[model samples]
Target: LFVAGPILLVELYPARVEFAFYRMSLCTKLGGLCETDCLTFKEKTGSCRADLTPLCCRKGKKH
Candidate 1:
């Protein structure tokens, strides 16, 4: 049983890591930072597209 647990975890690990990257890719592609707040210098709060969570995007100030 213990050996089986290790094997299962190893098999599932790559898929879990890949899913994380896929989720982050969408947020990044939309030019958004997945942060709790958008409070920063030269940053504005905006919505993100194709994101699973409620993403607080920090957008740069337009010149």
Candidate 2:
């Protein structure tokens, strides 16, 4: 007979959007380009995404 004391299980979610946001990688994936500084940009027309590295500069004007 075999006996087990305890077991731990962990599950990873790859389809989740929340987990998809990784550094600046998500920027281009979201149709936005990554920039060093948004203020230094020529256009300065787009906005930045939350908690993104190198600044995820989104295209189009703000509403």
Candidate 3:
């Protein structure tokens, strides 16, 4: 018999709202998955940042 392991829960958001502050409010209720010690999602904003880009996880790197 095969057993399943813990599943990774990923949340999907609309392109228009992914990095919006309003949507971030809802994330707080979800325990803020980005609080992990590993890599995390950060809102990329401003001229220096890429618009609507989702940060990718990297190995051997501390968030």
Top TM-score hit: 1
Model 1, residue 39: what's the lDDT? Answer: 54
lDDT per residue as tens, model 3, 1-63: 123222222233344345455444444443342222334344322221123422222233256
- lDDT, candidate 1, equals 0.62
User: TM-scores for all candidates?
Assistant: 0.55, 0.35, 0.24
Q: What are the lDDT figures for the candidates, one per model?
A: 0.62, 0.48, 0.34
Q: Best to worst by lDDT, what's the order? A: 1, 2, 3
Candidate 1 segments whose C-alpha is farther than 4 A from its true place: 35-56, 60-63
Q: In candidate 1, what are the lDDT values of residues 1-63, reduced to their tens digit?
A: 989999999999888667666755766776767665565653634444323544547567667
- Clash pairs, candidate 2, are none
lDDT of 2 by residue, 1-63 (tens): 123322211123333334435544666667767665654433333333434434666655546
* Model 3: CA > 4 A from native: 1-19, 33-63
- Output candidate 3 Cα RMSD: 14.2
Best by lDDT: 1
Error of 3 at 19 (Å): 7.6
For every candidate, C-alpha RMSD to the true structure in Å: 6.2, 8.0, 14.2
